[model samples]
Target: MTCVSCRTGLDHCHGTVLLHVDGGAECTEPDCADAVLARHALVVDCDSIEGGCACEVTAERLAHAS
Candidate 1:
């Protein structure tokens, strides 16, 4: 799986916020929120994960949708 925040595609960090925009879903790690906001200049509804991170949550959601 790929991490949207670092974009490292490695399991280094977890995402904190799941950003839902017009086209697709994106995410940001706790430390990467500022960077993500700077890059994506669109209105997004942030979904907070209770125990999981955005990366894990989003992946699970996508899998279920499929």
Candidate 2:
């Protein structure tokens, strides 16, 4: 599926999908979320399935050590 706002393919959106509370979906690409917001849409949630991006995991581990 493609993002409703940015039209980015699901596979190439870096696994970040922004969900509108009312309806619709978009990728988290640069300005993509802003585009959705410009339409007066509320992004109440998001799905991050980018398992390959370990930024979050590494941050968590470092935080725990601190």
Instruction: Supply candidate 2's per-residue lDDT for 8.
Output: 41
The TM-score values for the models, in the order shown, are 0.24, 0.27
lDDT of 2 at 28: 55
Best by TM-score: 2
True lDDT of residue 30, candidate 1: 50
Model 2, 1-66: lDDT tens digits are 645655743323233455643345665566544434445334434334444334545556778999
Q: Which ten residues in a row have the lowest lDDT in candidate 2?
A: 8-17
58 Cα displacement, candidate 1 (Å):
0.2
lDDT of 1 by residue, 1-66 (tens): 644655744333344335542235555645553435445434345444456445556776788999
lDDT of each: 0.49, 0.47
Candidate 1 weakest lDDT stretch, 10 residues:
8-17
TM-score of model 1 vs. true structure: 0.24
Local lDDT at 13 for model 2: 29
lDDT at 18, model 1: 52
